[model samples]
Target: MIILCEGKHDYEFIKELISKINVKCDVKDQGPRDKDFIIGHVVDGKRLSYVPIIIEGGKDRLDGNVRLLISKLRSVHGSSTWVLILRDSDSNDADSAFDKLRRDIVSLINNPSKFLLYKPSMDCGQGIRVGSFVYYDCDLKYMDGVVHFRFIFVVPSLEVFLRNYEYVNDDSRLHYAIDKALSDPGIVMQ
Candidate 1:
């Protein structure tokens, strides 16, 4: 599984969350560029390589970047890998944010074989908002397989997660780091 975050700070925070929850996975930062594109191709029927396609226009073109990454990934590989896109709901309306994200993802995928939305249950300040789908690429003869993609929105920004956790020290630092990064011109929420 590849976990894609908005920036370096978001990636670090997610790394902490994954460690606390004990989930073994590879986490990647999407960088500060307006669009960050990563592609992977199946080799020897074994694994995939991370190849990036960078475009200009900064944060405004985020959706385009994500779509490119998904399109390229699905076109080559199968459902063996799942992509988890972790985004922040900076404005407090997670539903709308997720809806827009879903639309963007669906637009890139012709017709996903499976699509599901899981609402967040903010019980005690911890929750999860998830959108899952399975899309197939018809280009590769032997690679006519599906790729699973998911979008997870962190409510009110990722600060909520850091504040609710027990093991993290200097919670204020974590909060400031994420907030500052998201406030930058290179960061886009919708």
Candidate 2:
């Protein structure tokens, strides 16, 4: 599983969450502002860090980064990899951000190979939305299963993932945020 984050801070936040959950996975630092960071990112036998250094862009480039990364991953890993994109909504409300992201994903996968199918939906009850892009092929040699492409929006910013604790300060050390979030009793409830 590959988790792509918008910036260094976002990557740090997800890395902290993964540690809290005791999961082993690569959460990539796609730079401070989303850009073409992972363009030549090699994923098979090489290390994840083999990706080229991309030029960081403005705050509005997250969508473009997501699009490019998804396309690159599809071309390289085919249907065997699952990509989870975590992006901050920034100024947009949760609903609006989700809608725009879903649209962008749909547009990117528009008229995909005849063997692939996709669905876009939101579960209002859980405040989660999903876009499933599935590729089906029986004879492929390298990658031949279903690949799930997910876009998860953190409303306002990644800080929302943490609960307010006496020790938690957004501007302080990142460890404090991680510790406070991990220590929160409600962390596992989600």
Candidate 3:
């Protein structure tokens, strides 16, 4: 499984969650030095899963990063891989962000009709919306084989979700919110 997210904060937040879950994962720096891509592997019984939580630097780079990563993973892992994209809604609502991301991904892949689209649905407790699309059977034009793409939108932003407060415009405050969440394991339950 591959997890692609929006920045250092998101990357750290996810790394922390995986640690809390007792998953045996090792974080390693992958790709170019300028790009922040972290790779980890989770051992589940006899199976080992490559879970790369890639930081695309910012939301603006998400579309291109997704396209590039998916294409590369298709060549390597093929139908065995599953990708999960995590991003914040920021100024937009969750539904709008989900729609935009879905469109962006659909536009990137070849023969969008071959994949089965799953509409976004709310996870009421977390206030997050999730959706996915799956490609099955033989290889296609751009894609080598089957692949699963799933996405999640953190309502408004990660800081808001973590702090349970209104959106903070300042970058420092956003970092502070993430820092606080890192210290409080209880924040994950809330």
Candidate 4:
């Protein structure tokens, strides 16, 4: 399955998680702020890279390539591939970010003849509110050959996931942030 990532740490973490599930995933190095890197990778069968930068006058980290990628993926894959947008959490504007993303998703949904989005969410990486929580109790669904959830916050650092993981499942690396999301306790933005 192809995963469009926005950060290197995200690449590593997702690589590890998918490996445990015995899924072979290609991870392109999408730097901390690099947003256009995934556009080419989605349409091409090759390893790619990009420099991290923010879009001009926009909260999104792209230079209009994100829409292009989405359009191309829909045209080429045609509802048989998964385009997962792996992004960072904007704490100050988390709600707004989600709202805008949802709106964009609606536009994609109208074009059912093309590929449709399965799960699209901006994870609040590294900056999850201290008392925030999220929960979903299911085997999680898969699209094409990938299984994706709309969104889930995580600590980017392996050290951080390891450090706080024991507070949940002490033995499994993938269980920390995942378990936290499944049994989120405390005040949340919802």
Best by lDDT: 3
Measured by TM-score, how close is model 4 to the native structure?
0.42
Candidate 4 Cα deviation (angstroms), residue 182:
14
| Candidate 1: tens digits of C-alpha lDDT, residues 137-186 | 11212144544545556666555544543324464477455444434455
Scored by CA lDDT, what does every candidate get?
0.45, 0.49, 0.52, 0.39
How much is 145 displaced in model 4, in angstroms? 15
Task: Give per-residue CA lDDT, model 3, range 1-190, as digits (tens).
Answer: 6577887767876776666565687643233232222222211212234456667778888767865554344333233445666677775466666666555655655444433342221121223332211111111222334445556666677766755533265656765565565565454332
- Which residue pairs overlap in candidate 3's backbone? none
Whole-structure CA lDDT of model 1? 0.45
TM-score of each: 0.53, 0.60, 0.59, 0.42
Number of colliding residue pairs in each model: 2, 0, 0, 3
Compute the lDDT of residue 22 as modeled in candidate 3: 54
State residue 44's C-alpha deviation in candidate 3, in Å: 20
Task: Give a tens-digit lDDT track for model 4, residues 158-187.
Answer: 334434544333445455554443344442
Worst 10 residues of 3 by lDDT: 131-140
Task: Give candidate 3's error at residue 149 in angstroms.
Answer: 2.2
**Collision pairs in model 1:** 34-58, 34-59
- Residue pairs in clash, model 4: 33-52, 34-52, 79-115
Best by TM-score: 2
Sort every candidate by TM-score, greatest first. Answer: 2, 3, 1, 4
